[model samples]
Target chain A: MRKTLTTIIALALVAGGVAACGNSDSGGDGKIVLGFSQVGAESGWRTANTKSIQDSAKEAGITLKFSDAQQKQENQIKAIRTFIQQKVDVIAFSPVVESGWDTVLKEAKAKKIPVILTDRAIDSKDTSLYKTFLGSDFVEEGRRSAQWLVKATEGSTDPVTIVELQGTTGSAPAIDRKEGFAEVIKADPKFQIIASQTGDFTRAKGKEVMQAFLKAHKDIDVLYAHNDDMALGAIQAIEEAGLKPGTDIKIISVDGVKDAFVAMTEGKINVVVECNPLLGPQLMDIVKKVVDGQETPQRIVTEEGVFTADQAAAALPNRKY
Target chain B: MITWTRHRLFWPVMLLVLLLLSNLFFTPDFFSIQMKQGHLYGSLIDILHFGAPLILVSLGMTLVIATGGIDLSVGAVVSISGALACWTISQQSDQGSLGVVVMAVALSLGVTALLGAWNGLLVAGAGIQPIIATLILMVAGRGVAQLITDGQIITVNSSPYKVIGGGYLATLPFSILLVAIVVAATALLTRRTALGLLLESVGGNAEASRLVGIRSRGLIAMTYIVAGLCAGVAGLMISSNVSSADGNNAGLWIELDAILAVVIGGTSLLGGRFSLTGTVIGALIIQTLSTTIYTIGVPPETTLVVKAIVVMIVCLAQSPSFRAKVFRRPGFAPPAARPGEPGPDAAPAGPADPTETKAEVPA
Candidate 1:
């Protein structure tokens, strides 16, 4: 193990040394060089978010120095510091997690590079660290999901048992979505959560947690999944148990992904609250506005909505984000 | 009699029982069972289904561990092989040819095997640490997988491909059958062949094995090859189940789960003794624990804390000190102690007990 560690370190150093060779042509004519550190491709949403940022940068003719942090905070910090060293015009990143980033953002701020957050938000109390945050209103999404569920089961006396599939623990979305949903559902004392688990925003975990919930709870009316992947996973578990998913246990999840819409249209999923990931155009607009000395809001929320099965069928053909 | 109690599986079994008992009390309807499509469908079944993949990986992991090595790249290999299979099936030119499909399968397995060999050579031949050797592939293999699919999700429309991962045999998932086959094959190979003995000898003392003319390098390389093959099979199961080849998400964090399964199943990461059955059971236990957490209405975020606590408890239970304390308690007798034998606490202070000393020695 020790030998492997040394070799890995040596290789990493060599790789890092070689990487420094590619930055000499950073457009010497004072171009707007933006360092965009992306979260790793952990999901379809993340992959799409990355493409949006890259495409927007290309379209805007910005010098985007991009790095894929591969979901590691340390890798992201290293990339950000490298960007600072290179003296980019602006720095931006969609952090994998919210904490452990104040120090890196501070460095970028000290270097005079305004940082913009995309997709996910940071947990820092000091809002001045990043220039602006542009993303979906996750809390609103949760509320919308809950509101739809309330409407779906308006007069049904069958007790509504919620089995929530949360995202990664401590993540901004997971924290906010749970809070927001709880706020909306707290009004009804009958609405009880029988099982809640962090599916870690992955399909496999979602299925695993849901299976456990099935064992622990004899009756389940609703599954509120934080993301489409988990909901889809829950759908599989639901079906595997010989119970009709949509009829037996209604699923209302966030992330208006294409698959979510498909599930809804097929009547397997009851509702989907859209969390627009194609903030590419909006993000680029904000970046241009911020760089051009125009005042911007601290929070820029993308337009979002809820889709039922009927709406899902109507929107499936045209829904892009 | 004490030797039987000190057997490695004893601790893991105790943990399984403790978890089951805890779930029985703390969780509502914990023992509830359901029948779906004429087969048992409940939390237990769900655990088996969910853990089947990890069990397969850990089965391979056991061999790698027994060879005094680790394969951090198994997860990456799974991703690559899954991506490769999806990419091949998605190829429009030879869409329906069985021969072409077979060739693609062979090629994907070949690539993974080559990667395993590379890791094996680095560790066994170049003397690189197994972790570091496999870590290289772990990081770089994802890039290669992504490159293969051009960072696109390659959706497979092939029936055979889907059947390989998502189909059922006699009401059981084909993936589970695949796992069963792999587990049974591995057991047979190890217990019924010289390979197991050679692996144990090599892991116990590589220098001694070399002195005795055992080709430890070849055995090490074969272990990796076997692991790569298992990963290839796992990749097929995952990709087909999803009907898509997602290079980024496929098999992500699987290595951690595989390692956790191996550890939980009573396999020492440092290598030597291994049990495929124990590993499978460990995988089931992990899945069941997660299932239990979700079943009882525990908040998902709390699962992290729950998993951490459970793992810590299991580790503590394995400690000799903890066992000794437990046995010393009133109404609790050491299972192996004779009627007149001194209780653990009553033993005179002397040279450290060989069993305790050996337990303290890090594998």
Candidate 2:
């Protein structure tokens, strides 16, 4: 049994070595080999983000080595180490969390391989570690949502009671979005947020919370969700309550996913502030630039647009996510 | 009065009532039900409607825990079943067809039953610990669910399928009716037959149960299958409610809630003397607490802390020893120690030890 165990271990090591050698050889043809790590398909927004990265990599003719970390930081660290070993030309990953990337990132820097952060930013103080951070500004998304709400409810002297359906509490998007909306809405004395609760960025919780909000506050005039899924859920609750969602309770949300566009066309959601997840094309451009020893900005924000019901109809047919 | 208070379900019912009453403090119309477009609409109905899934899952969990086993994979089963049903429905040419929806539901439940059978085999045949056996599926099942949906949320526009969760039946949410039928069927299957007694005996003492010629292995396996089926139904309700299936978020952490419900329902984790009514009340209490948090205007950051405190209070209130200790002042009579009753301290192995009778069945 001992001899067989030793033999099995030896064979496994040999197999792993062969696999590692094969990975290294794939980049030997002078093509730009890019290793990208993703933070798993936790939501529709994330799925779209991943598809964008994969498709854009193909378009750029970059040899992509992709790894899904499944929302675990340790898995991401392991993938980065493997990328370092494979000696890819560029490394990019959407960090699962903002912290704890300093160690793995320093290792990449030691090998002189530039790392780019996508869809999310890291909290590391060292700016020299990564080439650039490419993603949407969640706070700006929130500001745009508030801007649309302000315009829609303009000239109304009556107090517009808003019920805010936040994302997961303490998350970056939740905190920043709340801050930006509160900042923008602070200018209008007629706007009052009577109830604010976390929907955990999920459809079920959003619906459940919205039901409770409707019960607690009978005169809610507007609903702001941190994400589109929650808005969709709240729309159901609004409909069940015999209230017209977009007409009776103006609904504004972020994440211009396909479902949100459908709801917009249905006139359930009033507007959607797009937190664009399609950072793939821009990410590949930055990766090529970094590989060619060109200077890149430390931060690159993707351009997004706010859509209303009318725009949703024209955009519905071509909606990808 | 003494007999009523002594009942196992008494504390859970009282706690649920207290939770519902607390909501009245925030919203005066908490108990008022209104009719809207031929359907009942109110906080109470919402609690029942939303709490149905937890009640169903906990009912099955009560049986499994009664059989001396835990099924951590119920959450995973929920996601897998929902993912399968939605995927199947999405594949149909006519997604709104009742026949197609029924086929999808049947197929999903059938697959869930097979997964349950696999867990049962691992526990009974392979002699693996129940927690370990189910944990395998609990981790892998999400991946299977994600694979079914191709790591994307599958949304369907099936009106017939939506009736299971979001529709109304005779002015009540269909989900509530579904829960009532499942609870009634489970109660009848366990109490109106020898199954309940046999399960309690096996859980009370596995060795003694085997000596009594009881098929403990098959019984344990059947409990897991029932748990899987309960989770399957819950998955359908959840997906149908939203008209979409999210593999990652569907029924997430629901097994933990079900286990908490089972425990709060006065069912011991050591597995004997289960209470279906208590589980139902416990689920309602949880749902009410969630509603109360929002109604009472608890801050978003402090919601979890508030929930933990409420759950802790309910758990402490259910414990006889804790109640006795708290009401031990000189002027106050401990609730557990009434005037005509021997105190719980006096009778160390009194009515509380129902497992004692089952342990002697082999003799």
Candidate 3:
């Protein structure tokens, strides 16, 4: 039938297009074809992270086939399937929110295209599904934030009434950071979280929710934002209320973005726990290691640190994390 | 009593009052206001600044709603335009060049317009539902934005952009002025032209409008194009404000807020009628409620629940069916009715005849 012939031709074209992407020099002292699926630009840090990978790929002589999933898991799955069809040598992606990736990872494993998670980690029971996760330890980042608070309010008579501006609910960072911070904060009876809610990791919602927190709570001694954006938003609300932000109420946040350091230098924010986003060098190192048939760990933990106002100011000119 | 209560705005107003009263009881200095730098500074101004984008997008949404079409892609359009503007500016020889800023704005608008037309073509020419058609772009546009930025925040040291996003014009924000212009222009466009009439006709009855030679499809597509333009403008403002082209986070979840604003303004999501003034007021109310909650020190965890309740109340109040039912109950009087004496009986004023009014038309 004409319809069947047309269908066959259409199928052939698709197959040919995919096949064409695979004719690069083989991995024997030549370029390695890498299919990099990125969680679409949703934040400043994500944008920076993506650029790192792309630039690194160019420098490392890898033929990169990039796909942006636009912050959806389904799209990521489809992109991965396409990558498999293309038969790229290695697969790298930043999973958006960190679940529903097991089957896709298994498929990548079956294809022998090693998977590397950038920025966020997955919750898969099968550890072998991914070769390694190249990102900051989210738990440690949270603990650093709580530890700063514990030290700051050690001898204060006023029971430290803290409010938390959480990141996206059910996200890897949100889940792990909450667990890690609570692990430390639960030990002290005086320190209480009067209000803790998701700002959805957005500036607008952070400001909105912080406004409500300010209205309802009479005495919030400290604000612990899951990310710098929320903390910055809370700062706006704090200043609007004719109250000093870092001085009147001690503020601590995670994600040592350049803006966070700027806030710290201005004395608007108290401290920031760094979650390094510039993973270009590490990602390149891992990609080369994988392609060279060299053994690498299943998790490559990036070092994280906490910085106060003085440290933030001192390090502002040179801090890349 | 029953006849008098059949108004939509009654419920939303009541809900607003209830929210305010609750805040008064719970919050300290919930109504506090201060003067700073020759302008009002408080939770109120903060709400306005934050809510301006929602209001602008909602105004755009009002027209699309009037045509029985929804724009799920506005958020993505915003991201793309924001990224485009930032990337374009970053490519300048001089970082803060005005030529680059103007070119960036123009390029961003052109691209967004093209994308908007793509949606319009699918919905109008291909006869796809607006929701499904726009949803495709919603999923892909952000990816395109990321591609434009090479998945990195394209930082620009542009003065014009800083002014647009973070710079103040005398005492007010430049972003606020931009929003005002968009709102004013849209209001005049709809109110001062026959375009509004045509849109309502198409939304109210597409077949009837077609029979009357209105070219309904063209009108529908035009509304989308305009909405896209508005979103592009919003994108420029957002990126300029942040001084970075972060496509990922530039305008995430903005579409939802715009939808909420449209709904709160009593615009029927099913389409046919819209109110630009009401949309602005609605955005203000939502922003104020949010500010009040934060100022009053509501637990941040409870804020979502509170917002949900507020949305529900506003929606219920605006529903004619809900209003009619509430008014028919005892002890209920119409908002406009006198307090002491019942102005009218709970029955039809005259012998009722079944007549086909525009209000009775099924969507």
Q: In terms of lDDT, which candidate is strongest?
A: 2
| lDDT (tens digit, per residue) of candidate 1 on B240-306 | 6766777877788788878887877766676766667668767777766766666655665466788
Give the per-residue lDDT of model 2 (tens digit) for A1-321: 476568769999999999877785658788899999998876788899989989999999998999988777899999999999889999999877677878889999999999998877788789899988888888898899899988987887888899999987766688889999999999989999999999988888899999999999999999999999899889999999999999999999999999999899989999999998888899889989998899998889899998989999998887788
Taking the tens digit of each residue's C-alpha lDDT, what string does model 3 give over A83-105?
A: 88777888888877767888878
The C-alpha TM-scores of every prediction are: 0.88, 0.91, 0.78
**DockQ-based CAPRI category assigned to the predicted complex of candidate 3:** acceptable
What does TM-score give for chain A of every model? 0.92, 0.88, 0.89
Cα RMSD over interface residues, candidate 2: 1.4
For B158-222, candidate 3 gives per-residue lDDT tens digits of 88877775556756766787788888777667667767667878888887999989999999998
lDDT of each: 0.78, 0.88, 0.77
Using DockQ, rank the candidates from best to worst: 2, 1, 3
Order of quality (TM-score): 2, 1, 3
Ranked by DockQ, the better of candidates 1 and 3 is 1
Model 3 Cα displacement at A136 (Å)?
2.5
* TM-score of each model's chain B: 0.84, 0.93, 0.84
Worst 10 residues of 3 chain B by lDDT: B349-358
Query: Evaluated with DockQ, which candidate comes out highest?
Result: 2
Candidate 3 is scored at a TM of: 0.78
Q: Candidate 1's residue-wise lDDT over A54-118, tens digit each?
A: 89888987888999887778999999999999988778888888798889889888888889998
